[model samples]
Target chain A: MDLLSDLFLAKAAFIGIVFAITLGIAAYSTYFERKIAAFMQDRIGPDRAGPFGILQPLADAVKMFMKEDFIPANSNKWLFIAGPCLSMLTALMTSAVVPFGDTVTIGGVTFDLQGIDVNIGILWVFGIVSLGVYGILIGGWASNNKYSLLGAIRAASQNISYELAMGLAIIAILLFTGSLSTKAIVEGQQNGHWNIFYQPLGFIIFLICAFAECNRTPFDLPECETELIGGYHTEYSSMKLGFYLFAEYINMFISGAVMATLYFGGYDYPGIDFVTAQFGNNIAVFVGMGALIGKALLFVFVFMWVRWTLPRFRYDQLMGLGWAGLIPLSMYNVVVTAFGILIGKPFTAGIVGVVLLILGLLIHDQLFVKKKIA
Target chain B: MVISNIWYFLSGLTLLSALMVVLAKNPIHSVLYLVFTFFCISGHYVLLNAQFLMAVNIIVYAGAIMVLFLFVIMMFDLKKNQPESKSSLTKLAGSVVAGTLLVLLIALLRKNNLPAPSEVNFKSQTGMVETLGKILYTEYLLPFELISILFFVAMVGAVMLGKREAGERNF
Candidate 1:
């Protein structure tokens, strides 16, 4: 009973910490993405508030809080409200399965650096992400605006298409790791060889799909302001709008973290166990966590950098990527990689599989994809 | 026990949305209400300790199937109020039939003895999903595959129904 109580309390505390960290990072990412964009454009961004605009996110929060909430006259009032709330909720909850660091032991107690450890952790993450589309669909439909509705339709199709490829690509990863738990995947990568080296093709597909799933540039048809005038959130204002924006940034952060954990070897530095042996477990766990955070932040930075670097793909091109390009590539990766795993040559056979995939793609593009398009 | 409050809240929301689905003025509103009803139903599925089903329900029903409904509704451009076609006598008769069926269902439910829910016996915390998948793919694999083929045929039929012959296309 005492141990159970302690676990309950610890879980509650962990939930609080995860919530605060995710919400805080999400709020700040908006500021950071903007500042990064500014730097790329050779202009100062949001420097008026506090030193180097460290406080700008706070100011923006205040502004968002104070803005007047509005609903269109024809809107379904309940659904209009529910849309952003659901979006924000699903985005925030997905981070619960991500293992941030190894366990830390203190005072004869050990704490896992994750919100919840489920056997189906990867599935939980993917499942939660698939729900994020509801935000777009509901927001668009509830807005009762043509542009918003169109944006929602585009988003739903885009997300569903990319998600198939994404799931297939991850299945390829799972074939190698032979486990679906995020933590286990990280452990599998701890031998100084990340899955990205083994299954670079799958990693690239996953990375592309992750970007699309988050509705980032080149796949952000849901909120293409240039064309759709703010898309699904056009009818929203005040905190409702804040929720939409917050959910996007948080989704970006979660996807970035997932990518790092899945493909970039997570918090495993080259000789992390050696370091822990030299020092203590707690200190090593803390350092590993820092390394993980650093890696996650690097992916986050890349997300923003790509946003600035790449132009949005046309809707047709985006669909083509999802359907024609990604789906087949991912499926082939799955079949070959699964066979490799079964044959007891995951690393070596993965290389051959990757080579075959490249050759197949080259032949397909030259003969099939191009011919079909023409 | 405290977390149960959230579950209760979601359940209430789901029930309310279902009620609204029946009460809505327009077909479009009905469809929107139906989507919300799915959302709430998924919440209940979550509460029932089936996380996989919760996600699958949302994906298959709310995300994919409901979008098809929305698309069709949008294309049709339905009015706020459907035109009443049946007479008062017919409507009265229909109501009587519905009410009688409801009473019969209630009576049947009240009279029938239900088995008590089995105590939690599964070793895995994710009991429902694991068990369901085990039963579905193994013991019921042939039937499941058959049903899937049936669904494929139905989908093809739907496409055929939607398409016009080349000779009629110009017209």
Candidate 2:
């Protein structure tokens, strides 16, 4: 009974730890994004709140809380409430499947640093991400605004298009690792050789799709405020608006963590197990958790970096990237990877995949790329 | 049994939404209510562990189909108006027919003494999409092919219905 209670306590603590970290990181990422953008543009951003704007997110939270919560007169009150709730719920739920670290044995008990290490973790993550469309769509439709409706349509189509590439990219990784669990995927990359080396094309495709799916620029067409006037969240105010904004940041962080877990070495640095052998499993797990978090944060920084570096994509350009660029690249990536696996020549397979990708691109350009020479 | 509880809840939602689709005085409200009915039916699909079907149902029916409905409703410039009142005799007769149908259904249920369906182990090892594809392509292939033909015929019928005749005139 004591053992069971201890086990439960550890599990609860693990969840609590992640919840606090993710929520905190998500809140701060908003501030960090602004700061990064400011630095890029050579202007100070949000430094008035505290030392270098560290407390800016806190101040923003206070403002959001104190603001008057208003519901539109014409809206269906029930579904309007359900919209943001569902959005936030689905966004946070994806983290449950992400494995943050290996097992840490403390005192005599070992606990995994994941909420639930289910076998179908990858599918669960994808499924939950797909559900996020409802939040944007329902929120926009409930607003009864033309811009919001257009934004929702853009978001839905964007998700559908990019999801195909994302799924295809994931198939390459699955083919190589032959595992769907995030933990297993990470472990599969343990031998100082990440799947990224074997499947560079898949990695690039997944990264681009990740950017689009999370609605970061240059793919943030849904909320292109200059064009669509706040897109899905135009009608939302106070906590509803907060939920939409917070969900975006949380999703960014979660997807970053997923990328780190799936493609990067995922805490299997040069000599992780060597240290584990000398010191112990607990210390190793602690270090591994820190390393994984570091990697995830690095990816998060990259997300913000890319956002500031790139201009917002035009609507047509965005769709063209998904269909014309990413889709065929992903398909060819899959076919080549499958052949490589069958033939047991990963190096040759990677080269062949790259060649096929370039060939596909050349064909696309020849066929669809309008002749500017004319 | 848990699923039965969910079924009860979702069925109530579907029925209520369907009723609202007809009873709503505003045409836009009726269209919105119809979307809600589609969502509830999608919930029923999810409860059945038909995850792929559930997503497709929502994406196709609620998202795409209802967006078209909303577009038409918006384009039509429907004014909000109260429903036309029915005469007491007409209301009474409608209720009588509905009540008779309810009674007939209850009588049939009682007379048939339908045995409780033995619970089958329906949990699938494969993903919902894979299982659905396997079934549709293998065991249900003929029916699936027939359905495609039926869909094609329906498409032709719709075009015929929607097409304007050259000789038609406004009186």
Candidate 3:
């Protein structure tokens, strides 16, 4: 009973820490995005609030809270309220399965630095991310606005289309790791055995799909500001709109963490084992945690960089890429990976898969594009 | 004891949401209720330790299917077009058909003497992803492949139905 209670307490603490960090990172991501965007354009970003605009998120939060909470008269009241709440809920839920660090042992008690070490951690993240679509769908539809409805439909279709490619890409990695548990996947990446080394093509596909899944730029057709005039959240005001926006940042952060955990060496660094042997478990755990966060932050930075660099994709192009390009390429990667696993040459298979993917693209352009032009 | 309580709660919620799915007047509301029903059912799956099934249920049903339902519902301006009231005779016939089906289901269930209830083991690994994968690949491979073929055929059928020639209108 004592051990069980201790475990419960440890889990609760981990949950609290993860939740708080997720919110904090999400809040600061908005500020970071602006700074990154500004830097990309060669301009100084927010410098008003606190040092280097460090307090911008707080100011933004206060403003959001103070703004009038408006609901359009024609909207479905219950669903209108449920939308952002559901969005925030699902966005935060993915953190539960994400292992932040290696296990820490203190005074004979060991605890995982995650909310819950569920066996099907990756699937849980996928499931929760899939459900995130509902928040947008419900919000857009319930608003009773044409723009919102269109955005909602686009979001639903976009998510469904991209998820197939994403799942296939993940399957390639799963073939290498042979486990769905996030911690197990991270552990497998220890000693420089990261999945990216084995599944480079899969990683590229996964990264692109991750962008689409998060509704980030180039694929953010669902909420293209100029086209939809604020899109699904047009009818939302105050903290409700804040929730929708905040949810996006949280989704970005979680996906960054997931990308780090899956393809990158999550929390795994050179001499990590040596450090654990030398300095004790707690120090090693802290270093691992720092490395994991650093990787996720780098991914987050790349997400913003790409957002600023690329323009939103045309809707047809988005759908075509998802279905025609990524899906087939990911499928090819999966087949190549399967063959590799069978032949005891996984790395060779991955390299060949990448080459094949490029060749397939060139062949497709020649066969299809040449015909269309003629 | 705690597990049973959770089971009862989830079952109750599932039944309630299923009822609401039918009772809701608005099509959008009905779809939302249906999603709630899927969520409750997924909760039941979780309680039973079928975590993989629970995630799949939520992803496929509550996430994907319900969104499609909502998309279609939102496409039509259902707010202005109220449902027509059914005639008493039609209602009577519907009730009779439904009642007969319910009675037949109950009778069939009563006729079969189910095996005695087994002890509920909380630590069962039957539903784990690894175990399920092994069983599926070894024992259920044929059926699984057949199901994929079925889905492929359905996809082709849907595309055929959706496609229209230039300047063609079926209606």
lDDT of each: 0.82, 0.82, 0.89
Enumerate the chain B TM-scores of all models: 0.79, 0.72, 0.85
TM-score, per-candidate, Cα-based:
0.85, 0.76, 0.94
Ranked candidates, highest lDDT first: 3, 1, 2
Give the top-scoring candidate (TM-score): 3
Q: How would you encode candidate 3's per-residue C-alpha lDDT over A1-374 as one tens digit per residue? A: 35368898888888988888889999999999999999999999999999999999999999999999999998889999999999999999998888889888877889989878878888888889888898999999889899998898899899999999999998888888898888889989899998998999889999999999999998888887788987888899999999999999999999999999999878887898799899987999899888888888888898999999988889989999999889988998899999999999999988987887779779988887746444
Q: How would you encode candidate 1's per-residue C-alpha lDDT over A244-321 as one tens digit per residue?
A: 888888888888889988988888877787888999788888898778777877888988999999888999899888
DockQ of candidate 1, scored on C-alphas against the true complex (2 decimals):
0.26
- lDDT value for candidate 3? 0.89
The prediction achieving the highest lDDT against the true structure is 3
Off by over 4 Å in 3: A1-4, A363-374, B96-113, B120-123, B163-171
lDDT of 1 by residue, B92-139 (tens): 999999999999999998899776666776443453556777889999
The predicted structure with the larger DockQ, 1 or 2, is 1
Residue A86 displacement in candidate 1 (angstroms): 2.6
Cα RMSD for candidate 1?
4.1
Off by over 4 Å in 1: A1-4, A66-68, A106-109, A177-180, A364-374, B2-17, B26-50, B70-91, B106-112, B117-137, B148-171
Per-residue lDDT of B1-171 in model 2, one digit per residue for the tens?
366887898899999999999888777678768877887987887676666666567656664566556555544434444356899999999999999999999999999999875568446544466667788999999999999999999978987996668998733
